[model samples]
Target: MRLMALFAAFSLSVSAQSVTRAGLTVTYRDPADRGQLARVFTVWQKAAQDLKAKGLTLPPATLTASRNASDFASLTGYPAHIAAITLKGNIYTQRLAALHARNLLPYTLRHEAFNLAQPPDLPRWLAEGLARVFSGEAQKDPPERTGLETLSERELDTLLARASGLGLNRVYREATRRAAQRLKQQGWQETLTLTSR
Candidate 1:
């Protein structure tokens, strides 16, 4: 059943973007409701400002709502895809917060903002890790374990078996220690560079 469901999703038809903003020189998908254009711009504009404060900005963003599975596949190449998929109600990432939600908007914008500030050609893990760092959720007492849980069950078991020798506190400390190192070495701009790739 799960396999069938995955296949169905993969074969779904995707719609392409039809409207392009000539004045701003940006691209957005053809919205079903034409009136939504203003709201779209408003949302994006506000998101841009929030991101700028976090040291990230999108020079111009291309927002699209694709129905095709291939369209989603193609988006793996873009940094904004972090927030882009979430713009659609159905495709939120398990590891990240929703982009449209009021509380999460700032973090989502900051993640994309870093993409805008850095050079492209970065590795996915590096970019995702850094984005999660500035995501604010990371700084709390218990960080979001989504990224860490991304490993397959088997992979996780392997890691856990190796880590079982250590106490829970020791393991957590090590994880944070490594995360801190990443923050110090790459910083924001460097991490963005890694993610944009």
Candidate 2:
């Protein structure tokens, strides 16, 4: 039991290197990625401002930039602990890279940060949609619309039929649309408050 406990402690220490900046903490394996870390800090700063504007409390956030796909999958296992984890190279990396090229990294970062702030019980649609909304990507482009608005009736039906096989992208789009509609009807503060329950 002592050996196992020691191993667990050592493993946790080796898994991540962290830095705190502007009230945001970032964890990663490579210390050389300081530039990327600063970028994440900027995103968090913007997100904090937006949340403050909405009169919402800013939850403590720790952004983790996973070294690779495997790391991302592992780090995200306990979603409640961290605010967000960005994979170095994965299926979505190509698309995310394009967004970065367009200087929209902050938007993506903000989206993930919003995910980190909310309770786990929050509905997928509301969580993802609010992320897009907070990130300022809700009205930007179709790719950014990861909520119900992006799906057609037929596609929605198919997704419903194969709920177990539903993709994360589809969830984001559907949630974005649903969240937008709710925001329109209920307003921001109430929408955020709903997540608590």
Candidate 3:
């Protein structure tokens, strides 16, 4: 059964239409969704620029848009695929509506892009936090309050509450907020060095 499923996903991926932009290639089932493709490319380009400004490099990546969340889950082995995911050189996402519903396509893509840019050994807090910061989700909070070391246990408790019910969004938000704070205080290079440890 697993082999059959893998084969099916492989076939689908192979058969999908592909478009390349800014060192990233995106594949999807519908040729008509070129608008989404354009948006994705724009987002990636902006993300690459942002990372570069921060003295980081974005590795080449391939993105695949699945027909639905179920297909995305099947392909990625995630119970709920959410907005997007990156595995090594590849990124997988659902169609545009789903991504737009959560306003997460850009954020998710950038998150995975960060993973590709940096070494894989980063702690989850740092990784998710940096992604969220880069993706513009952590702009509201002051940098001084965001360090993981500085965050109180009560704050963490509040952020982690109802995790299963609300999904990992809160956790990600906290991490991102903390990361943003780090970026502001230490700059990207130092933050990257600290997190890579």
Best by lDDT: 3
Clashing pairs for predicted structure model 3, backbone only? 129-175, 129-176, 146-178
**Model 2 lDDT on a 0 to 1 scale:** 0.61
Clashes of each: 10, 11, 3
Better of 2 and 3 by lDDT: 3
Q: Model 2: per-residue lDDT, tens digit, 35-148?
A: 566566776787878777877556665555655445545655533322344433111111223335567667767776666665556655566678788888777647554445
Instruction: Give the C-alpha miss distance for residue 194 in model 3, angstroms.
Output: 0.7
* lDDT ranking, best first: 3, 2, 1
lDDT of 3 by residue, 151-170 (tens): 66345545554354344655
The residue-by-residue lDDT of candidate 1 on 1-197, one tens digit each, is: 99998887665422233344421222323233234445445545665665566566556544444332344446544333334333321222211112333355445544554444444454434433444554553565354343553454344334433553234333333344444566697665554444322
lDDT (0-100) at residue 11 of candidate 3? 85
Any runs in candidate 1 off by more than 4 Å, and if so which? 1-40, 54-57, 68-70, 74-110, 119-126, 133-197
TM-score of every model versus the real structure? 0.38, 0.62, 0.74
Candidate 1: C-alpha RMSD to true structure equals 11.2
Best by TM-score: 3
* Candidate 3 accuracy as lDDT: 0.72
RMSD of each: 11.2, 8.5, 6.6
- In order, candidate lDDTs are 0.43, 0.61, 0.72
